[model samples]
Structure formats: C-alpha cells, structure tokens
Target: MNRPADKPLYAVQDIPGKGKGLVATAKIIKGTRILSEQAAIALPFGLPDKERRKIISQQLKTLNNDARNAFLSLQNRFPTKSQYVGIFNTNSLCIKTSTDEGSFVDQAAIFLIASLINHNCENNAQQSWNNNTRRHNIHALRDIQEGEEITLSYVFSLLDRAGRQALLKKSFNFTCSCRLCSLPIRESQRRDGNVQRVAALDEVAKHQRSTAPLQSLQCYHCVLAYHLSKYGREDCEYAQAHGDVATLLVMYGDLARGRYFAQKAASVFRTLLGSDSNEAAEFAAMARDPSRHPQYGFSMKWKTSVDEIPYGLGSADLENWRWERLIPEGIAPFADIPSKEHFVKGGTSKKRHWCFMGEIVKTKLLHPVQLEVKDSGDKKLALHFYSSNTSDTGNSLRPGQYQKGYTVVILDALQYRFEFGCGINQEDLRMMKIFPLRLAKILALNKEVREFSIRHDDGKRKCHGCGAKAAVASMKRCSLCLSFWYCSKECQTAAWTTKAHKTDCKSLRDPDLRGLFFYNWDEAQDSISFPLQVADDSC
Candidate 1:
C-alpha cells in the first residue's frame, strides 16, 4: 500500500508489542486533520456471518490492486473459516448511513489507514465519519510529536482501570497499556471514582425535565466539575458536559451564562470534531442567541438578557460568577440545607448541609425504631433508626420529646428507598438532633438566615440588627448562631428580643446545628468536630 501524495503527516510502521500501526512522520498541531480517506470495503451491519462474508467477497473483487493489498494486510486476531470475514470484523469501523427505506442503518466499513491507528485509553487523536465527504476523518486532539504512535480510544465510555483492562482484552484480544492504565493504584482509583460520579450525574440530568430549574442546574454543575477534575480540558467528555450545562441554563432563562457555556462547548467541539460537524455548527449558533433554542424558556426564574454578563472580574471571581458558585457570606458553607426530593439512590452524596426537618406524628420501637413524620414541605415520610443499641435511637430524649408536634432534625440525611415508602434512615447518633420548636418556626428562621444573615463580597455585609452594611471587621457576629452580624451589643440585644431571634437563638445553640454551619460538606478529607473553624479554608 502507498500513502497518498497529500497524506504526509504519518506513515505505517511496525509498533512494539503490536502489529502494523500509524506513526507520526512530522509534528502535528492540535486540531489538525491528520487523515481523511474513503473506505476500501463496505458491508451491511447486523448481517449473518455467511451473508456478510459473501458481501465482503463481492466488495473485495471491485477494489483496485493497491486498495485490495492494503485490505488483505490488515490485522485479524480472530481467524475463522472465512479469511475475508475475519479481516472485515477486525478492521471495519461502524458508520451511520440511510437505508433504501429512508431510515437509518449502521454499516461497517474497512478504511486502510484509519484501521492502522492503535488503541489508547488516553488517546491523542479522535476519529469520526464525515458524512458530507463520505469518508473517515482523524483529528489530533493534542499536539503529536514526530515518531509518536497515532492512537484513539476503542471504548465508547471511560471505565475503571480493571474494567478497561477486561473489556479491551475480551473485545480486541489485547490489553491496553495506555497512560491512564499505568497510573498508581490510588490515583487510578480516584480518577475512576470521578468518572463514575459524572456518569451518575449524567443519568440524573436525563431525568430532570420535570425537576425545578435550580436543582437541575446544580446537578449539571456537579457533573461538569467531575469531568474537568478527572479528564481536564483535552478530553471530549469535558466539552459535552459543558454543552449539557449550557442547555439546562438556557432552558431556565439564564441567557448570559448559557451563551458563555455554549460558546465554550462550541470551541471544544470545533477542535475535536472539526468546525463542519453538526455539534459544532449547532452549538455555535446557539451561543449567538440562546433564546432561539427549542428548550429555552421552560422557566423564567433566572431570566437575564444575553448582554447582562458582568465584566472586569478577576479570574477566580469570573469563574464564580460564570458558574453561580459564590458562597453566600455568613450562611454556613456546608449548611445550605436541601430537601429530600433532591436525593437519588446510588447517586453522589450530598456535599452540603441538608437536614430532614419533620414533626414526629407517631413512633414505634418494633425491631428497628421507626417514626412517622411530616417534613417542612408537608409531605409525610418514615424515619427509621438502625443503631446497634435501641437506647441510641432517641438520643436520650424522653417520651414527651416524641410528641406529635415536636420537630426532629436529621443531619446529612439521604433518601432511603423502602418497600413501604421512600424515607430517611438515621444511622449516626451525632448526626441527629431534637429541637423544641415547631417545623414552621424552624423553617421561618431558616428563611431569615438565607436573606439577612448571608454575606456577599460585593463590599457589603448587612447588619442583622440594624440592617446596615458594615466596613470590614467592624461588626460582631452573634456568638451563639454565628449567623447574624451586629454593629453593637445594644443592637444585638434589641434585635434578639424584638426580631424573633429570641426563639431561634436557643435552637441554633445545639452543637449539631452549629456543626452544620462549620462542617465541610463538599468531601471529607479528614474527621471534623464541633466549633468548626475553616479547616480547609474553603469558606
């Protein structure tokens, strides 16, 4: 086989521990189109072995002498009765085409040079079918040095190291020795965990059509973070994740951020799949006017014009504004409480302080202690306590504490899917607390915290007592809740007595309640305790 006159970037060569592979002959810049070639043979997909072999033989007769030689030279690890069929199976790449009935059909085609590229879990190049040109195009995902092997990932999705090894060995009859597969066990496991979490978040995004806009946007942000942390900017999944987030933001009427993310997604797609790809063209247009999208305006909760984006922000502030990730000042970092509806089984654990605040309607101690309770949302759910000692279930509370109107707080609670109903399973003694206040009073206090107590770095901090912005550290925080700031002791006392803080201060004094504000909820790097100072400097 001979290389075409225009194809001078790479050449076919014998690779170590592998058969014939493509090796770069000259430096290839990122986003460069390295190879574009028509298939030497094509056959219908899903055909029986006998029928496919007959078709392959017929196509083989029509190939020119050079093309026929190249097809015959391709690798065939699984040899069978029909040599032509085995060669086709080993070298053919699946391509989408239309059938005579005007419906889509997947067809397998053998490309002489494209098939010669080897497999790598962390591939430096990507391949796609260019339907407009009726050929396969390979683009450099990153700059490829001369003498380096041209590679692409054979698997559709990334998997753990062990899973990748098993899948490659079973399907391709070879083990992958890529960069990711050769990492230390601990580092490899961390990367695998990130990928798995992102995959879970992807499933959540798919089912979030009926979910609230803010909640869906949160899920998409979490997915994007996982992808960037694991695969960095070069991975194709990173771009796709941004696209998912952009779509959700646009749907919820966040036009400024939506267009920003859409443009980022379009840039990456242009690099990986070429500017002519449908994904690149579609996202490029969406970035120009996000409101034009079909799914745009599902909710107007975050409505903003495309030109309303902030300017002149520092790099860190720019990212915070772009993602809406600015931690509200004064409101405890991990303690931005979430509802039970946000939970998903086998999904990523909650990284912020969330409690199931419910009134105990009834109680039973049969085998495992159970309580029938109604949450802040007025939805009833069961709370099951599964401690080794039954005494630990109530946390030393008297029978009077289990009254129908008494509020029970379970910290960092998750949604437990039970045969009877979906509820919460209280496991840790320290994670649960009982408050004398009713559920309504507690929620009202929480609303106050969200509005007046939370701080923002826009050079403003509203005094909880006087409702005035203080300069720097001139204000003092209420020592109990550490929630509200005051300009003076007199103001604090007047507000505490007159502003309903008198009722909320006692409930906030509980160690568990204070811990919720201080604890690091994103991920546990180390054990934590009460009177939580910023251990990770995350705040």
Candidate 2:
C-alpha cells in the first residue's frame, strides 16, 4: 500500500470482541486526516465469480513478499477454497477509478491497515474516497483520545436500533454494542422515533423538485430540523440538509435566507471535505450569488434580496424567521390554509393537515351540487358535493347561506381532475364549513392571528383593542370571536362597538367558523374527523 510520508496517527491492534482493529496511538482532533493510502490490491466489478477468482489469484502471485503477506493477513469472514477471493471479499473498499476507455468504473480495493477499522453506530471517524489524490482517506469526525478505537458506521445514517442490529448481524456476522445501540429501551425508542422522522423527511425531500415551491420549502424546513436535532451541524447529513433548504428557498424567491443557508452549507462542506473539494467550491459560489441558481425567480412569492436577512433576534426568533414557522398565538384552532394547486392526488400523503379556503362565487345543483369558488390568490376553482343525503349537504347550509361572498373551508382538501377542469370534490359533510365573512376578511383575520398571537420572549401580547403591547395573560379575549385579547371589559366593549369586532364576532361565533381555526392542521399522521376539537392530541 502507498502510505503517506507522515507517521500514522493510529495502529492496528487486537480489539476485545472484534478480531483486529485500528486504534488511535495519539490524540486526534476533529477534521484531522487520520490516514491516506493507495490500495494494496484492486479488482474490477461485473466479472463472474470464477473469472474474478482467477484474476485475484494471478494478482496475488504478482505482489511482492511484504505486500502479499499483508494482504493474506487481512480478515476472511467467509472461508472458501479460493483463499485470495475470500480475503478480498472480507476487506475491500469500493473506489471509483478510470477504466481503459477513460470512463469511471467502480473497483473494490483492499487497504491493509485501514480495513482493520471496525464498525460503530456512533463512529468517531469517517472514511471517504479522495478522488483528487486517488487514495482512500480517513478523517476524525470528532476528537479521539489516545488508545481509543477509531470506528466508522457500515450502515446508512438514521437507522433505528432494531434495524441496525438486524442489518449488522445479517451482513457483518456481528452484533453492535455502540453507544447508540446500548441505550435504555425508552431512550432507544425515542431516538428511533426521531430517526424515523428524519428518514420520512428525507423521502419527502427526494420529491421536492417536482412539488410546489411552498410545499418544497416546508418539507425542506422539516428535514433540516430533524437533521439538526439528531445529527448536529457538523454531521454530513446536516450540512446536506442546509444545502437542500437553500436550493428550495431560492426556487421560491427567498434570496436572503437562501444565501444564509447556502453559506452555512458551504462552511460545513469545507470543514468535512476540505476547502478544495468540489462540493465546497460549488456551495461557496452559491453563497456568493444565490440568484445565479437555475431555479431563481421561479416563484417570487417570498421575494427578498440577499442582504435582507434580519438581525438582532434571539435564537428562537431567528429560527422562526428562517423557517417561516407558524405561531399559534391568535390562530384559530384548525385554520391552516393550503393552496389547492399544490395538492397532488394519491401522491400527496399527509405531511401535515391543511385546509382550503375560498369564497362561493356561483352554485349549480347538478347530479351533485357544484359550487364555483375563488381562492385567496384570486384563482377560481370548483367544489362538488357528492353526498346523496340532503341533510349532509343542503340542510347544513340555509338557502341564502350558500350565496356569493360566503367563505367555505374544507379540511384535508385534495385536487381532482374532472372533464370540465381541476377542482376539489367534497364527499364528507363534516369536513366542510361555511362562514358569513368574505374571503378577504377571513384572510385578513388569519394575518392578524399570525402577527399578534405569537407570544414574544417578553411575555407580551398585542392588544386587539388599542394596538398596545404588554403582558396580557390577565386580559379577556373577545368572548364571541375568541380571536383577540383585551386588558379590560372597557377595551373589549370598545373593540366590539367601534373596531368592527361586532361583525367579526358574529362571523367568528358560527360553530363552523370557530371549527375552521380550532382544528389541528399540523397533525399529518391521520385524517381529521368532523365536529373538530380544539386541539389535536395526537400531535
């Protein structure tokens, strides 16, 4: 093997349960290169077992005595007549190399010393193929004390404890006793839950390219959160999550946060892969100029300049701005609204609960009642009622209540393509609700909820009556709307009589209106039922 000129940081030693393993001989700091060596023996892929065995034997015969002795000393988990093939199978690292045709091909190579590094679910080191040097490189993922065994994970990240144990036993012929695997049952299960969420978020991110910009951003935010919480900022997956979130943000026209996340991704990539790596270079370019991204300006829904990022905020406030997290302060219980155009048919599983809000523009009673509606974005769509029983449809709304300007909210709304055009088909009466307010007024109220309801660190609420900000826990909320806070009955009376709360209170008191905001729109694991409760306990 072509070893680097520098003295090695680790040495091969006998591990207690594991046969031979690599252990640090000196303290190794995080990001330090532990080893760099050329392969001792390399074999091409896709060849038949017989032919491959013959090739490996011939190659073994050609090696010098020292090299041959080292290769023979490697582990052979699978004993077979072809000893050379057995040694190679037990200790080969997959590397990419150029073939005779000048195209890249995957080759398995045996590294004499590096192969001795054992597996750990919570490894302290990472092994990567450095294509520029044409050598296998191992780096410390965290500080390693002298005499500590340097380890790497053989399986993918975020696997649960049971999954990790099963795969290690089935493939490696060993059971892992890593720190993560040795945790108590309750903590192990909690970690498993987090890992499962990370995996689900990853699955969602894979399809973000085809999803609507807003939906893609939402998925990326969730993915980033899980990665950061489980893996920390230094983990490769956490850096990758930042990069993905940056891309989606730029696609949706949020250049400020996009640039911020891109810079973070670049910094992490530089630390993990060295400053000269292609990944670091690419992200550095993105951080410098996010608008140059191919997806820039696709949707200007959240347009912002690169320098528009906010300053002087606490960590929580900063995170809230970065993720566009919805605060529940003034929000009606189940009032989260999602655009109809973003809903996919069967492909859109419940990532989170969402409702569609639109105003009735026209109504037709065909085989099933059809209502023409206009969304908050001024886009026109149709909602068709398919209930056979009038009690479930017409009886739910008084004759004049279905007239123009009335707002309708449907939970778990989905897009359906019909002969006429694409729209929503309503089948459950419990999922549908109508309010006397206009679509604009309802949206305005939602905006107010977004603004005043969120509690600040100072424990203050923005008074709906006078626009004053103060600690208002002792204050009374408008009893009718349950949508605003007031310091006293006088303020409440004034807000009711003078601030147009009279009309707002009447609209808000409609059980359907209150239900629209009270439903748990963030719970995505199951379908919501009617007679919507104040909170989703499942979440």
lDDT by residue (tens digit), candidate 2, 430-459: 777777779889887666654555455677
Query: Per-residue lDDT tens digits of candidate 1, residues 1-539?
Result: 11123657998899988898999998888888888788888877678889988888888899889988988888887675478877787777777766677676778888988988888887889887766667787888899999999998877554777888897776666777777888988998878876776677677776774574554555666666655553544567778878887888888788998898999999988888888776788899999999999999988767889998888866654565675522222222122333234332231232234345787787866455678888756777787877766665444445655666777776556566576766777766566666676778766766666556656667556787878777637888788766777888988988888897887777777655545544445542333322344432221
Using TM-score as the measure, the top candidate is 1
Per-candidate TM-score against the hidden true structure: 0.65, 0.60
User: Cα lDDT of all candidates, in order?
Assistant: 0.71, 0.71
lDDT of 1: 0.71
How much RMSD separates candidate 2 from the native structure?
14.5
lDDT of 1 at 86: 78
Off by over 4 Å in 2: 1-5, 44-47, 96-106, 230-233, 310-314, 325-539
Off by over 4 Å in 1: 1-7, 98-103, 230-233, 325-440, 445-539
